[model samples]
Target: MPRLADIDEISSLVLFVASDDAGYSTGVEFVADGGNLLGPVPAAKS
Candidate 1:
């Protein structure tokens, strides 16, 4: 199972994005998943 991200970790990202520091940031997608989409190493075979 993939380890879930801590609330603090996600919160920090949100805060950064909402802050003035991220003013120049645009057209971005923040993938907060803990590599869950990757599944097992080498990936699963059909």
Candidate 2:
């Protein structure tokens, strides 16, 4: 099952981008889709 992202999870990314730590990061696409972009995970074989 896919897990949903918590508010804190997304907020942390936002906080980092707003902070000086991400100062050099420009024109970057920050994806916070909880690995959804990687496609669905295959089911385990029994």
Model 2 lDDT at residue 1: 29
Per-residue lDDT of model 1, residues 1-46, tens digit only:
4677889999999999999998888878877787777777676799
Top TM-score prediction, candidate number: 2
Q: Return the lDDT, model 1, position 29.
A: 85
Q: Which stretches of candidate 1 lie over 4 Å from their true place?
A: 42-46
TM-score on alpha carbons, each prediction: 0.69, 0.86
Give per-residue CA lDDT, model 2, range 19-45, as digits (tens).
999989988999999889889899889
Best by lDDT: 2
Among all windows of ten consecutive residues in candidate 2, which has the lowest summed lDDT?
A: 1-10
